[model samples]
Target chain A: MNTFMGYERPNGDIGIRNHLLIIPTVICSNQVCSRIMQLVPGTVAIPHQHGCSQIGADKERTFEVLAGTGKNPNVGGVIVISLGCEVVDPYALADDIRKTGKPVEVFDIQSVGGSVKAIKHGTELARRMLEELERQPKVPIPLSRLKVAVKCGGSDATSGLASNPALGAAADALIAAGGTVVIGETTEIIGAEHVLAQRCATPDTAERLYHIVGRFEREVERMGADMRGGNPSPGNIEGGLSTIEEKSLGCISKCGKAPIKGVIEYAERLPEGGLYFMDSPGNDIECVSGMAAGGVHIVCFTTGRGTPTGAAVVPVIKITGNKRMYDRMEDNMDVDVSAMLEGAMSLESAGERIWQEILEIADGKWTKSETLGHQEFSINRIGPSL
Target chain B: MKQQIADGVDALIMDNRDHVATVLREIMSGDTVRYRDDHGIREITAIDLIPFGHKIAIEVLDTGDDVCKYGEIIGRACFAILVGQHVHVHNIEGIRGRGDRAGKAGT
Candidate 1:
């Protein structure tokens, strides 16, 4: 239990996987990145629709998220693809990830000749990086080296009782082992923000928690609608939730009972350890993408109703507490804690089960998401697409 | 502690001393239900028809008194409430300094 095998980076970051990633800094370079991924068997690429015409925080958020994703411990090396001039600076992003001591290569479509030349160049660089990554061997690392993001999507009544709390217990275990655990979805904290604030380790942390909640609320209101009517999602309502507050209260359980160490902005690199909160939207894909982009090595996602969502790089471990849903979506699920309701399993036992699954996943086992090829990626957008 | 019940179809945290429990089955006026306090489950008859997961006022609470759930006040009753009536947004108002969601708890 003390150590799980992982690939160690030169910067001292331990990676669960030694994946060589091809990151496209702009939408224009997505095809090139994807082509590179297709050519290189072990390489992964995330094609997002942002990085152009975005200004201020939105543009900065893109750069930070993309850089963080590349720097995630799961990636042993990275190759960044860019269009030479975009809102996000590819060199700066490369520099940011290079600090992790991993091999980083940057190529621009305009700088490297043209589209045909860029694709060829990007593929060659990706192939070299993949070969270099393949040379690195995994070593046994302490459990404390792990950092996990806890999430829930497609929730139902059973989510609170089963999967969320079960994941929370696993989160608590990770924190106890001196590892870092982060929980996000600021919008889901709406009606329940106060309760979480009280658990903050410091007054400032508590204030920041509320500040993020307020900002999301005000921003949503500016769009001329309330969050309650829409926050639950049509599926959530049909599953039995009534209001945003109702949904928020249940969503908070995935974090477990750890002290809220701090609140961070969306896509920001997580401060090393303990439980931190990432300010993010509740939209499942965006939420998972933000966590993946923020350097989370893996994500423990809970659901009552199911979703087949995954990330382009980070492995998403799907956990469900609903027995029926688990049975129906067995192909999509990784772990099931539904036995707790039947008195066949203790909550702690269920948590330990999930923790074991996480360890196995971190050790390079493919999750149901990965096996099924569910690499769904999307960036939360702001401003107009110009 | 007198126990308040979370009514309606959604799950809820009723008392700060008691864990928020989901409503598995619906109840009607005069139907007897059991609620747990610090000691154990106490049986009480519904004063009015109550849906699943919606809260029922357990003790006399004034406006702004923190409504407890998951063993903490999730929000405050927006208005006064009798001992055995439904507690929800219609009656429960948010205390709102830094509490987690308003009514739902134990998630």
Candidate 2:
């Protein structure tokens, strides 16, 4: 069994990278979080327009996503800053993260006097947390302890042909090694759900799979519209896809042929082993963010077109099978499996290549997105902002 | 080998269901073709104007007939479909189950 060297967290999770995360409880505190992250070297803060004016499930979703992100194994420690009057409580958020056994500190701008005062207090706590995190050491961890999330964006014809299938092979390889793999984008799976259901371990799991698809359809129906008009984007059509089912059939290929053990909600903790499904929207950034918050240490994103998106903590490995697009966006991409289409490479060969890349990345080799400083972050909002 | 059509676009082969060949390209009228009793791809000589990503109705399909593509039934044809034509929003519709609630309404 292969293994990689990584930092062993006090909470029993192995982390590929030790990241110091700065979180804001409200959109109002984003500036402060950004300021602190800038002032303190090696600290990363997520800036987003959420955490306020949300009601019911929407507000809870924000809170859960925030806490889950902070608690992700990749994060060594966290510094949570709040506006004091937001819907999400800063102290509670800090407590939730502290459960991970990492260093956690919280401060409210209103309670700490103001921006200047809050920054001052935040700087002190951030410095302390960073110092403590720096004290942690790396340990040898099995590859099976690692979880990778598979995603795709800006898809094209070559996606299903070269990139996604290659990703599927890689996903199967990881699962064979006893490592966990997760695939999401429920909207993209619309046409191929039945095929996936057939691969479910049992009848109940199959039923559960159908339930997820039904839920999304009903939700769309509630919006008083039909998906017949749109699901495959203009880009998908231009790239040669005609319907949602057509696009979905190709999209579902990334999951490979592993038995789906369970289906989980967005940003929820994944199952122990094998392939799992996370319920996430098709928006690239939001889906990736949800996976990160769900505790995935790395993301394996396959694209036929291209996107430059990275998470604050986890490393994102961008793979593509479109030779032209790969060359066009070499800076943003890491693995190019286009040779599979050209017949120079086999699917298993491509999968082996990706698995090697995963090992190197886990050992601290920065992905193209990370080196380019593409730390794009966004949370999917459930309802309209008021 | 078990071959299933993920859709009308990609053809997938596994070990379980090897009886039928899935559709790799869309078929149209005036096109000649041969496939399993389920479905087959025909060459478009006259090009009867089929949508690129949509499925083509290869043979007579009953209401409960499993719509085959990539060697597997992606869905059940909601209505009867004619042979050698297009199959998509016009004929096939999805049936979702309960657990698919993580993303937005549509793909």
Candidate 3:
């Protein structure tokens, strides 16, 4: 099909799901916001251990993630819950989310009396907002309007051999159809940055690509720690990956052959209609969260060893190339391209399978991650907490 | 025309320029393994037992030589590597990602 049913946002973006999101501005407000989510069915809540005791960039990162999560097209309405004395400003946070033209309501525990009263007040607001969100109509939107993030984690040999390249083919197909695709994981791109740099659309983009990898390497040095200590984690080694270079060569294949449009900071908004790179950590949950905050509609996560991490505001479609892992983790995996390894299916055919899954997901089909309630969220931090 | 090798394909070569191919399954020493890529199918005898997913050198490499895979340099050979030998961290050092060796050759 040329189009899928989606909620058209007032900011001219298309969202596959219309969700009422309950956002807690700090760890102190998590219980109350989660209580509201439990009270109101169909409402989603992101409870993170940040927004308090965080200084400078760390504090700003928390605010950005909360605001970005609320501004995400998938969230039709938002409730910003604050502890009243946290570092994050609730009114400003609500106003930031309002830039998307979505309905945002802000409240605080101290101002609303106590936990019991706050929960009651938040529940009432959430119930009304959920009812309003449910009334939002799904209109037919062109598939090209979709923005997808490409990520791989728990990678093994099959990840590089089958799933990654297959996803790359799908990424290429989507880009060819005029859709936007994003690839991240700055740490994972170290050994293979040259290959990606050569594919950059401009000389400046190529230089920036190198700059980020160099910067990440220097940061790892500042800690007097070897990146190899953490990278190619024991799990990766057990799964047959020998070195970070081998793993990286495989990791970079998931973005397909599209020219790199530009490099963006973590959680930065993505440009429309091309392949872009977001500088993010290789940590699965944080990378996926960054993409969701950057306004991606979906994330196609490829794995061989397997993981069940999903995003709070975007659907994550898990694809694997190991038949055994797929069978072993059937509940977590969505598409199995292991047939390609056995020569039963060609790469193009395997990619077509993932592409079809993407279309189905875009048409409102729930991914295994979403159905299993995997709304894992984490913000990649660059600074220390106060 | 590119020839297609019969079954028993135990490894996969991603490109013609690759110095190594990935073992798809456990391969014992002396086993004549088959591999295929865009260029065509080829066979090589395993000199050492290679574990699944680990790479095996497809071509000989002298010390300090760059090991190419996926048609790009993934690492550098720290010592001589012969065809059919297991290619890994023991013999090849990563050219990137290590801060101490950022601009240095074969660690």
- Which sequence of candidate numbers ranks them by lDDT, best first? 3, 1, 2
What is the lDDT for A155 in model 3? 92
**Which runs of model 1 end up more than 4 angstroms from their true locations?**
B1-21, B25-107
Quote model 2's TM-score for chain B.
Answer: 0.47
Per-residue accuracy of model 1 over A1-386 as CA lDDT, tens digit each: 68888888888888887778888889999998888788778788889888888888778778877888888888888988899888888899999999888889988999799888988888788777777778788789998878899999988766766678789889999999999999999888887888899999999999999888888776765655434446677676555554566667778888989899999877888888899999888888888888887788899999888898888778899999778778999999999997765546777888999999998998779999999878787887766666
Per-residue lDDT over A1-386 for candidate 3, one digit per residue giving the tens place of the 0 to 100 score: 88999998888878999989999999999999889888988999999888888888788887888888888888899999999999999999999989889999999999999999999999999888888888888899998999999999999889988899899999998999899999999999988888999999999999999999989888876665456648888788777776677889899889999999999988888999999999999999998998899999999999998899888989999999999889899999999999888878788888999999999999999999999988999988877777
TM-scores for all candidates: the values are: 0.84, 0.82, 0.94
Better of 1 and 3 by DockQ: 3
Ranking by DockQ: 3, 2, 1
Count of residue pairs whose backbone atoms collide, per candidate? 23, 28, 0
lDDT of each: 0.77, 0.76, 0.88
Model 3, B1-107: lDDT tens digits are 01222356888777788899888888899988788767566788999988888888889999999888777787789899999999887888775556665445544
Model 2 has how many clashing residue pairs? 28
Docking class of 3: acceptable
Evaluate model 1 with DockQ and give the value: 0.11
TM-score of structure candidate 3: 0.94
For model 2, give the interface RMSD.
7.4
Which one wins by TM-score: 1 or 2?
A: 1
